[model samples]
Target: MSVSNPTLITFVIYIAAMVLIGLMAYRSTNNLSDYILGGRSLGSVVTALSAGASDMSGWLLMGLPGAIYMSGLSESWIAVGLIAGAYLNWLFVAGRLRVQTEHNGDALTLPDYFSSRFEDKSGLLRIISAVVILVFFTIYCASGIVAGARLFESTFGMSYETALWAGAAATIAYTFIGGFLAVSWTDTVQATLMIFALILTPIIVLLATGGVDTTFLAIEAKDPTNFDMLKNTTFIGVISLMGWGLGYFGQPHILARFMAADSVKSIAKARRISMTWMILCLGGTVAVGFFGIAYFSAHPEVAGPVTENPERVFIELAKILFNPWVAGVLLSAILAAVMSTLSCQLLVCSSALTEDFYKTFLRKSASQVELVWVGRAMVLLVALIAIAMAANPENRVLGLVSYAWAGFGAAFGPVVLISVIWKGMTRNGALAGILVGATTVIVWKHFSLLGLYEIIPGFIFASLAIYFVSKMGAPTAGMVERFDAAEKDYNLNK
Candidate 1:
């Protein structure tokens, strides 16, 4: 429980640096565009790292490793799904979305894009999309809080209650001070820290356990199934695991990186960089968990006693493998993962409330400066909600993340993909898709049907709803014309 002074100092310096970045970013943030999308000026490196950092979150460090440690190679399916999904998203969706969103009314947020893309004069589409974002992201943000709390609880030996608030406070301060720019910049830094920690931990663990062969032998001795990829093979399970890739298309935080890219041309380079980063980071994370099984099996005394929560494997290994100062920096990487994603989630929610709700409904005439402050307030509001939701120390980061990921993927993934690619996608169909996807995910999750992941059913039904409803209702000439123009713009850029 006793953290060395040097370790405590390291944590403080890292937290302070994030806040400093926010202060610096605040100076350049002049309008909602700057606040929400960094004036659409992020270069390839920032865009790629920001998107990677925000998308991976604490789940990458804590949740994924824990799942791998607990369930063995079977959990790697999620990583496989994510890599494939991320690549496709970059190849098919990123460049087109970057071009089309800018062309379609210079949209600042996803809700703004949805409303503009479909020419929904009734404002229903914007409202529905914004609601989905707010609802799912609130839960999504709570996963980060849970991850942060877990990190703090393990590292600093703080109470869950104190750790929960402390963990959230640094993220809130930085995000509230600056908006998208701060989030992006901090994310770049966090991504670097995360990759460093992920890569180093596994390598050190492997050396400590003698080598890979020894580690494998130890793990196999503990449980032969640890190496069996087909231990619990099922068609539905594989499909469900791969379905996670579908969630990337709908994740607003990740999409915002694409939307904020400096140019369509930048997306190609960013995509390459992102994929490379993702592959390395994911591989490292899985190794940490898989290797931890061997390390602990060889030296169970280091772990103290067996616990149900295998998520603690990473933290326990860090403490045992490294000196106090080195462990502090590595542990801060977990906090970095937590803060990076939490900041992005808060900004996305704030953008929804500020641009989609406030500007649309209450303050159409509000000045840019006023709206920025309102966005800050909304960031605090959402952070408070997520903190309350994450108050239970028993809450698993992966479980919360999976639920929110499914909600976003089902509710908005199909609609976003179809809207960008299909000109015939009617506003009515968009509405139906969102409603059906959101509703189905909630119902399927609650009812527990066939033990299938909710996203599989939700995505299928939502896609069908969009296709059928759009066929039932014709698109207006204006809608068709606008779609033509956006399509033309996309092709021209290509």
Candidate 2:
């Protein structure tokens, strides 16, 4: 029960502000498209900030910091890998996804685009992709919920289960009201706040402990490995951790924002802004964790048991520095990171279920109004499922987040990267790629592999399976013609 009165007051104010923003955003949304894609009228700043915020999330606040606290400098490479991957996603995927998505009758969902673009008139691709989105995103959202629970427990001394529901309810309330417009706009605001908090916290913590010289000296004094870039991580561990960037290619929540951009031209500006924000925020966060190790090392009594839970480093620092007001703002920044991402993902998952699954397969004649309600209902349903899984706070949110990311990356990354460039990608290939990639991830994650590698093994085997299967089967004539025409025009623009 380390609840400071000022901190509690600040937390209430932050929650109120977020709820207000969600209500304000709700007024702007008029329909499903408006709700899901903000009517495709977003600017460069909103797109960049939303994309970056959603991509980073609890991992940025918890996972990145924890990694730095545990392993030191080597963890920075994960930030590097992510920044590089995000830059490429913006450069290569953003503009094209925007144009092609609109050209294909303004498709709103990933499965919708996949089915529509390749003329999968049978709707198999849409249904399959939608199911994958729902399944993976459920787990993904669970990870975020768990992160929220951790934040509540860390900052407010609340029980994990109570914190879990509160987190889920707060996230869903805003998302249901504001939809995509609200989520993106709030994400932009949160991203700015996150960047400020990360930068300021590290500097202040470092300053508190004498200076940079003393901070480094203290970290080195604590553990020699803390000073080494290759600390504790073997080559395999290093590569696996860093290779998390691969998930960028297949993330639906990320791609949906890109596809929903108002114009391709916005991507260039968005990239510059997005990359700058990511590097600074992620870089600063890692530095904070490293600084925390020293801050606690010097004043172990002040930090209490926080040193054990690396995620609490930021909260612990907040309690130490500044007035209650500033600390509240800092705490809100962490919640902002959690809520922004959780809301965006909930919307994306809901859209997939309503548009791709229910309307496409379950009810072909569903009206827009009915579909809208279904989307809302689906959001509630999925949020509850995530909350149920999140009850056990001990589960590693970072590990779950990583597995979900890798699963999506392996399953759809190769398929999507190929769809953009290779004209010969058949329906069979896409289907095979999705199945093989998804199956490999599941098996590798749970079952003991028969003397095979871990994360990378799945990616390699799945990718090869897709390629090999495509070669053996003749291209679906319908898909070959459609893909050929689309590829020609797509190439000409490039």
TM-score of each: 0.98, 0.94
Please, what is the whole-model Cα lDDT of each candidate in the order they appear? 0.92, 0.80
RMSD of 2: 2.4
* Model 2, residue 340: C-alpha shift (Å): 0.9
lDDT tens readout by residue for model 2, 1-494 = 54557777777777777778889987887778887888999888999999989888887878788778877888887887787778877877777677667766678988888876667778888888888888888899998998888877777778888888766777898887778887898898889999999999999988898999999999999997887877766777667766777778889888877877777777788889999998899888889889988988888788665766776777778867878789878887888888888988899899998888888778989877777778888889999998887778678867888778877887887777767656566677788888888888888878745433244665676678767777876656665565656555555654
Per-residue lDDT of 423 in model 1: 84
What tens-digit string does per-residue lDDT give for candidate 1 at 1-494?
44446667789999999999999999999999999999999999999999999999888988889889888998899999999999999988898898779877999999999898888999999999999999999999999999999888877788999999989999999999989999999999999999999999999999999998899999999899988876686878888888899898889999999999998879889999999999999999999999999988888777662256788888888878899789889898999999999999999999999999999999899999999999999999999999999998889999999999999999999998988888889999999999999999999999999888999899999999999999998888877787778778767765
> Model 2 segments beyond 4 Å from truth?
1-4, 448-455, 473-494
For residue 276, model 1's alpha carbon misses the true position, in angstroms, by: 0.3
For this target, which candidate reaches the highest TM-score against the unseen true structure?
Answer: 1
**What are the runs in model 1 whose C-alpha is more than 4 Å off?**
1-4, 305-308
Residue 362 displacement (Å), model 2: 2.7
Task: Report clash pairs, candidate 1.
Answer: none
